[model samples]
Target: MYQKSLVELAADLQKGAYSSEELTRACLQRIHTHDERLNSFVTVTETQALTAAQAADAAIKAGTAGPLTGIPFAHKDIFCTNGVKTSCGSRMLDNFIAPYDATVTQKLLAAGAVMVGKTNMDEFAMGSSNETSFYGPVRNPWDETTVPGGSSGGSAAAVAARLVPVSTGTDTGGSIRQPAALCGVTGLKPTYGRVSRYGMIAFASSLDQGGPFARSAEDAAVLLGAMAGFDARDSTSVDRPVDDYVAQLNQPLQGLKIGLPKEYFGAGLDTAVGDAIAVAIEEFRKLGATVTEITLPNTHLSVPAYYVVAPAECSSNLSRFDGVRFGHRAANAQDLQDLYTRSRGEGFGSEVKRRILVGTYALSAGYYDAYYLKAQQVRHLIRDDFLQAFAQVDVIMGPTAPSVAFKLGEKADDPVSMYLSDIYTISVNLAGLPAISIPAGFSNGLPIGLQVIGNYFAEARLLNIGHRYQQVSDWHTRSPQGFE
Candidate 1:
């Protein structure tokens, strides 16, 4: 039951092989039994999940159930869930219960998917590794001692452990793909504005986009179909028609033109991980696709540009948690100034504070043009690079991360080293294009991911290509030892 993909689970529910309630209970039981070791979930809504499962069963009986009906999934803690703690792995929101559902929550619920809980994540989506999470780091299920890649690490880890078949995650500079690679799950970051941002806690407004993590690309497509669409409530939500992601999963990849950015394969990529990606690309070639060496010349500037832009936006968005309206408040305050300073100081974890401070400095009057403005200008160059590449190729491919999951504390003290973990993925976000990371192979018993990038609003195409690759590969079906 735990190993079944979302599509299989849905088929089971439709055929009455098992009641939705039974399936939901099994998922909840698994979480209770195995999650302590993984520390993947921040909250478990057993009662709510059971109730939703009952409703889904009722819907199935009434012949109105959808594809996601009764499927148990988790939301990354960054999304606001009505009446549930919406902590973004930060002490600031530890006591905050959202008064409303995030757009993603509402859509999934309407589709009849059962929510088991909220998964843990990096503090306000700030770090590349899960160590910055205030709830504690999420250990990779593959090798317990290693770090699950961040921000979306908990979501990826949950799916990898089969705690849930699929989970919601937000990508801001590789949050979704990085962890998906490390945890050996399928993760997707849809084109910017493809999914609504309404009610999702803001990290970097422009860079943050919610996506999904699942065992396979097929499962991911099903969830993405339900999670995406125009939302007038979110100013950034594009009014473009949502693609039927699942409907395109079986599309053939023959004659597909794949671009391999020379820069990505050069320095920084780990040898084993790069080799795994090389094999994955050859498999694609065997499927009748042609691979070409393409160049995204400005790739080198992505990290520096992302650091400045993301932090700048985070500083502005996180300013609301200053203890005035809600969230954690300092118990004793000398005055308003003391209250604001002490509350934020105590509320945010170190990484969050570091980003906020850096963002504040970048946006400060004297440095605005020197830092933030320069980063934005560089962002355009990154976006243009992708546009230029797409003119000659159907998709671009690369190693999702520089290497496989490292020991939990390996790069915690070295922020720069940790940032490079996302060096291959940040460019996608900077370009506002769709991208996915699927398990390609493993190194030293840990997983590596192959990243596939596509042009704007090309999620369906990306998922299709991923689904085809998965048909000939079993990496996505592999599970962590104890968990299986």
Candidate 2:
């Protein structure tokens, strides 16, 4: 039951091959038996999940169930789930139970998808390695000592370990795709505004976009169909028609022009990972796709620009949590100012504080022009570079991360090294384009992901490209030895 893709699981449920209650119990039992070693979930909603499954079974019997009916999936902790602890992997909201559901949560519930639990993540979605999580790092199922990439590591790990068939994730500077790369699953980062942001904890509002993590591209397409749509409450969500992503998954890749960014193959990329990417490209060529080298001239500037822009927005968005309205508060405050200072200083983790300080300084009056403004200018140039490249290419292909999963503590102390892990992915967020990472091959027993990035609102096309690749390869089907 756990090995099936979401589409397969849905089919079985529709055919009455198994009950939703039985599948939900299987997942819960797996979590009980194995998640202690993985630390993947922050809260498992056993009673709630069982109740939802029962309702789904009734709906199916009544001849009124959706595609996602009774399919259990995990939600990233960043999204608010009414009555569940919506900890964004931080002490600041450890006790904060959201009173309302996030738009994503509401949509999935309406589709009759059962929520199993909330997955772990980097605190406030700040770090590349999952180590910044206040719940402690989520260990990769492939190798427990290594960090599953973050801040979506727990969701990625859960999908990879087959604890759940699919899960929700958000990509703000590679949060969704990076961890999926390290954890060896298919992860999609939809175009900015493709999914609503209402009730999702903001990281960098402009760069943040909610997406999905699944074992295969077909599963991702099914999940994204339910998650993508216009929502009036979120001012940034685009009022565009959602495509039938699942219907287009089997589209052939003939005549597809794939761009290989010259910058992506340069310094710092591991040879093993690069070789894996090359093998994946050859597989595409056999499928009748043409590969061409393209230059995204501003690719080198993405990391610095993202660090500046993301933090600036995070600093602004996180200001709402300073003990005034919601989130953590200090006991026995001397005054208002004292309350704000101690609440924030005590609630936020070290990495969150570091980013907050950096963002505050960048947005300060004197430094605003020199830092924030310059970063925005660079961001525009990066967007322009992608726009230019897309004119000749159907999609851009490259390595998702520079290498396979690194040791848990390797880059924890060095923020610069950690920031560079997302070098290939931040530009897509800066440009507000859709992108995906799929398992290409392995490097020293660890998986390497090949990224397929498309122009704005090209998620359906990207899904087709990934789905075609998965049809010819078995990497995405492979699971951790013991877990399998």
Over 1-484, each residue of candidate 2 has an lDDT whose tens digit, in order, gives 8999998999999999998999999999999888999999999999999999999999989989989999999999999999999999999999999999999999999999999999999999999988998999999999998999999999999999999999999999999999999999999999999999999999899899999999999999999999999999999999999999999998889999999999999999999999999999999999999999999999999999999999899899889888878889999999999999999998999999988899999999899999999999999999999989999999999999999999989999999999999999999999999999999999778989999999889999999999999999999999997774
TM-score of each model, paired residue for residue: 0.99, 0.99
Q: List the residue pairs that clash in candidate 1.
A: none
Tens-digit lDDT track of model 1 for 1-484: 9989999999999999999999999999999999999999999999999999999999999999999999999999999999999999999999999999999999999999999999999999988888999999999999999999998999999999999999999999999999999999999999999999999999999999999999999999999999999999999999999888888888888899999999999988899998999999999999999999999999999999999999999999999998999999999799999999999999999989989999999999899999999999999999999999999999999999999999989999998888888899998999899999999999999999999999999999999999999999999999998975
Candidate 2 lDDT for residue 168: 96
What are the runs in model 1 whose C-alpha is more than 4 Å off? none
User: Where does candidate 1 have its weakest 10-residue lDDT segment?
Assistant: 413-422
